[model samples]
Target chain A: MEGLNTVGLVEVLTLDGLDDVVRVLRDQGRKVIGPIVRDGVITHDEFDSVSELPHGWTEDQDGGRYRLVPTGTDEVFGFSSPSTSWKRYLYPERTLLIRARRDNGTVEVVQPQPDAPAVAFFGIRSCDLVALGILDRVFLDREATDPTYAARRSDVFIVAAACNRPGKTCFCASMDTGPTPRSGFDLSVRELHGDGRHEFLVEAGSERGTELLATIASRRATTADLDTAQALHGRAAASMGRRMDPQDPPLAALDPDHPRWDDVANRCLACGNCTMVCPTCFCNATEDSTNLTGTEAERWRVWDSCFSIDFSHLHGGSVRSTVKSRYRQWLLHKLVTWHDQFDVSGCVGCGRCITWCPVGIDLTAEITALATPQQSAGRKGVPS
Target chain B: MTPRMYEVVARRDDLPDTVTLTLAPVDEQCPTPAIGQFNMLWAFGIGEAPISLAGFENGHLIHTIRRVGAVTNSLAASTTGDQIGVRGPYGTGWDLTRAAGRDVLVVAGGLGLAPVRPIITELFANRSSYGRAVLLVGARTPDALLYRDELEQWRGRLDIEVEVTVDSATPSWRGDVGVVTRLVERAPIDPENTTAFVCGPEVMMRFAAVSVVDRGVPAAEVMLSLERNMHCAIGHCGHCQLGPEFICKDGPVVPWPRVKPLLRVAER
Candidate 1:
């Protein structure tokens, strides 16, 4: 901590050292939120003790399928991200934009400042962390900065978890987002289980993380420990169930009349589940609510999806009306058009949409459909 | 973080369901709007809508709004001296520099004439900067025509070619009758050197673009002001997304070929 580089300082952490890290985070007035196994899914939530982590449970995720399987591993983090992303925190589904009160002569418009809580993300997955980075570019780096996102993102600490065991729906390797996040983390923790011992190899990725790790780092990592940790991440990378075409641009340069769009549209419900769970999809619509008496009014920004008909609503009607058009918009927006706007693909390959989708429509397959010539008899059934 | 306070100084009924309101900034400084640029007008207790600058009479900012939805209804209903909020003279506008020595072709259909009003204002102010100018206007009916008196006065000018058409004309009407596209023959423009600007309903713009393009104007030389679902009049809100472009940020005014394929889309 005294004279260390602000980034990339790896250290060994024991079971007790993990507890110390959480304690230090909380002691600094930051609300520590981590993973907890509840009801059947491993979800990110507020937790104080490391004991709350899904200890021996790993998630099995296929297209339109998810299950909390008992992996029998005594490691803390054994699952990838759930349907919930850090977008819930950084960019809330519903955010208050403006508040107005009818004065004696005129309406006093009040654009309210956000109430940002000092919090630390305790167990952010590499995929979700990548999603946060994309959100940062959209909300912070854009022309009109979203004050709500800036407020929530400014003071929060990110303690990301390297994917030791990638979930069944994960394809971070294809997207080049993870099994290991490149940047935008205060600290990153990788879990390792070897010849009869379980331990964590934590790395301080920022100045604050370095300072915090000074108190919790049990020992500096030896060569053998580093190799074990690297192997674990390599295994997770190789084990992804889905593989998007990292070679071919996801949906770049698509023909407007591509038949693949029609095929996917037939299966797509247009329910907006993909956009809702997707880590990088950031389309939204604002709603205005007024209390009784019609004196005070408030405007709130709610998460809207490209799949929703009203997402592209104009003066007379919606811009994208048909399911085929809606799906086309979503796919093109995420894969191709997003590159033109943000200079990056919108999807992080987290696969929340793949698992959460009730119809089991996979972008990997859809993108492949666009590339491959249509077969005489198309492959049958959804990816479940 | 507060919206600039502005008061409506004057209101002119341009057509049925359409009014041109002139606004004067109160304590806030409003930037001079370029032709084809728009402002997000906020109605107290209601919401905001992006309306194009329709030129100014004196020093006030003018916006011609058609009562389409909620925000516009509030604006269209606003009386003179009523208070309203304003933000942005946002997005890139029509580059008059590109059309500097070239002929200028302005096409307007129905309320689309409102946004192009600024261009006409600019043309009249600097009559010699541009080459031959023509304004082709189309309306659903003779009664639906906007700024009828202004159109008559402008037509009197020997400098500009102003041809007006109606889809359905009355017996008393003496001018051209038929679609605005048909008037391309009447307003003989040197398409090679003419830069066309179109604003209207999507279908009208599409047909107008085709006719203008057929008249020897390149597709890229023809620009159209687009309408998309814009929430944040910046790039943040995804509502205004059109293919690779954000109608709010990248355009509102864009070259035809950039959005040509997208315009062919039924829903989007």
Candidate 2:
């Protein structure tokens, strides 16, 4: 592995050689988490062997639907994205912040140290990669860093997977975040298939990636292989199932009282599924609980959604009590207010929100409906 | 940030459900919060709530808490010598320097006066530095008024104009009985020269802010403190978000023009 100028070095590896990459990372005492078939659907989980990878399986994702389909071919990175992104690993659903115990008359407070382990994330999609960057800005690039998120995010080995077959709900191309890995990765893998030949084109994006690649048995890529990889990326980019207008006025500028909000509220469930599935939605609430004896207590940070009626609760009552207001807040926050807060759009065009919403409400379509003046004028006075 | 232990040294019942507890750090001194800044008061096994610094006495942090929720109920119920966790001095504070040579108009309703009490204290301490100063306070009823003694003392001072009003009055009550906005409407001031600070329930704030603006004060010159469901009190927790601003960090105090559009949007 020594003396290898790994950065930007592209190489071709067979299916067997691809398995060695996971072996090498595991040998280095890192937890390797990647896409796997779980409950007849693709989801991320920890695996020690490459055989656990969801080979020859693809996902069919559309508005309010998801299903796994088996492809009669050995394609390790066939799925577009799993049900969840790497967020569950980087920022767990729940974290213990502090614990306390009451002595004879005084209370003693103790802050619990964050539990973080070095992890290698395999087969990360490009849209989710951008989502990680967005999360970094939220948690790390601030005056006070979230200790739990910082600890887990500090030591991560990212292996990006370039998409070849974009999903039915994917719009990463319109978001300008996908089809091909751009940056912020240690290594990137592109699976190529055609003409009775199947292989993986792996490229070292960082020095560590190059060294790791040198440990595995692989041959340097030729010009023909590079051309084939570029063509596949081009095809993937053209095959996006949805598109958003880059010139669409910032959703913040849309009328807050637009009739379209009422229209969407009619079908909205206010279940907060979109926020849960979204890679960058970072709202959370803290809970304090005590033991039966009332002597020991713990404080925990749990993910919370703005859609909950209690999210905007003050002394008198909830500020946003109706489903219309909550749904408006979620949409406006993602497409409009997020840019003002984070200097980046919260929606990465991953379409997880569209696919997971129980009512099949597509934000892209909603944005268009809200942007159209005639549609709003035509729907005025329509009861929700 | 982890909360540091603070021992409640003194407690004063301001109202039936409200108490002002003066806390002294068990070991090191916690950072002194500026006027309008707040601290996350942790009630041992209850939880944490963002409480504004009502005042500071000698090195102790003073917080006036009203029992509105579980955490506040616990905090309000705490007696002297009870130890609680405290973390903060968070959020943007009132820039009193902006009011140095200007006429100051402070309008507070209900418990909102707690956050601006320090500002009022500073204005009285540095009386000659500012022009005409006026304070208008309102409560749901006469019994619900906070800082009753302090309001009486300020009313006696001839230099500052102090008006206290209640939504409903007892038969013996002689003070004004109306919303605080009525006082805002009739306050004696050069509209162009006055900087107004208003805080209260959201509806009260909106009406009071509009009244202040109607009195010809620039929207930017009118400052209001906001409240949201805050978990971390830092910007990381997204609960306190209001449009582009994080109420816990960017403000609990913000200029009116910046949040005017947001306030117009109901439930934003």
Candidate 3:
């Protein structure tokens, strides 16, 4: 009752308006970033026009494997979500925290004011919006708000493209964040096209989106169009190949001696790739880099992973010295202790960890194993 | 608040690699720090490290730093007139007021005494409020002992019992020998009515905690300071996490029962 914000307005858009969403956001003085193929991978980066969008591209994503293949249909939102998350834009990997310039006698130390430019997303997925929400709770919800993240997140405008083509690795249904997001975005778009028809069912979740949708010229959606969109969504939800239980017993609570722990440990290299790609992992460490003459120094907060042995280092030595211990900490932290710390779940089940991991670790299988003692014991070898 | 400029008013080399820097803010009034809470001291060109407030006297705050790494070494090397930056009187502090009318047992090992020092000062300043107070300190050797003169003054007090022990002492050394945990067994205090505060290396704290708990002191009455790799005192950075708790914000001074499970796991 006290701290909640008033809900944003809602509206619907016609099919043709999907192409103009970026232009509308840009006219509002916001820089736009969207999906693009870079170095043979579908990733989110700065883009100028819709032509730069990865058209006709769909991704083949399995555990530890990802490939961008052409779908033969000219579709922009056909692919799975990328390896990079909205965190790269909102809660940037590197941030300048403090700067101390030493003159002759006095040292002027200032908390550097963050320069945040308003940015809009062209095609953010529902899982990404959920990840952003989780980050908001961590940074903005706390008493000591992270000044950097708060400044950047304030003016962010999101345009979410609902997942109609779920990736092989996608498990957003299990995480309860998507194939479709109920709310938590400025605008929602379901790109429905096939068999000589090309259109998008756009729904506004915020006043900004409602105003922007009014600028694009398109007809009101017929009842038939809405029915077609609903059928497409139902089919997509069923097509999702991956599934995970966020709170599977023994593993979700992370029973330490569960034999599966040792099996996962043996396969886990502790390379930190999973954490790097995980949408909800927010661990960071601060470092100070001094100038050559050493008169001035700047404190930088950098991206850090729990898998690194140096992460748990205290005075004597690392608390998690072995690969087994480190892997245990990372998984336990994600599935179990994170809930204890944040109240909300840490994972959005985007499956980036599964697709990006070099060792092909699937969290869905890991969670399923914890269902029974026999299953945990049976899965001894790492999935190929 | 961000770190403001502070000058090293005076410096004292208490031991070979340990030094105490008495700091005073260059401009504004620095707030009084609480017992068991720490300050993130920045060494001009080097990084910041969290050091417990050793003492607060007159217009200066004293921090006894051990030169273990780059940041602390730079801070320990700093002399009078050198300027450094300080922020935060951060994290939770000891609950000395709750220990009123109860015997207070203070156990410290080596640099661990730095954090427990403030509690001792508070106990002495308001001696009538609390029951009998006992301080048992332990170090690696006789030379490693800190605050020699103040320890003498505390020993002279009729109201307090101060005992010092070193693992190995020089031939000239004269005091108790062995670990501080051993001293807790024979310490003069009412165990049932006593509150124990411990700060030390993790192994030593665990043993000291067991000794006090075995003496009939409830586990809830035992307070221990947890140390970790603290990068941010405000708890944004994830370096200081111990299980679900962040050592910087949730603790540095947590009740033993609260952290007992976290402390029990070797590599959690």
User: What level of docking quality does candidate 1 show?
Assistant: acceptable
Q: What is the lDDT of residue A112 in candidate 3?
A: 83
Top candidate when judged by lDDT against the true structure: 2
Judging by lDDT, tell me the better candidate of 2 and 3.
Answer: 2
Worst 10 residues of 3 chain A by lDDT: A1-10
lDDT of 3 by residue, A1-384 (tens): 100132533334434456577677777788998899988888888776777888889999998898888999988788877867878787788988888888886888878888788898778888888888888877885667988889888988888887778999998887788777667777777777888887777777778766777677766666777677778777877888787766556444555546776788888878899888887888888788878987788888888988888887766688878776677677777777777777777788788999998989887787676555643332222120
Give the runs in model 1 whose Cα sits over 4 Å from its true position: A1-7, A373-384, B57-59
Position B139, candidate 1: lDDT: 91
Q: What is the TM-score of each candidate against the true structure?
A: 0.94, 0.96, 0.94
Better of 1 and 2 by TM-score: 2
Task: Predict model 2's lDDT versus the native.
Answer: 0.87
lDDT of 1 by residue, B13-79 (tens): 8777999898887666577777889888887667788888888555578888999888899889999
Each model's DockQ score: 0.48, 0.56, 0.43
Question: Local error of candidate 2 at B125, Å?
Answer: 1.8
lDDT of each: 0.82, 0.87, 0.81
How far out, in Å, is residue B240 in model 2? 1.4
What tens-digit string does per-residue lDDT give for candidate 1 at A120-156?
Answer: 9988987788888788889997567888789989988
DockQ-based CAPRI category assigned to the predicted complex of candidate 3: acceptable
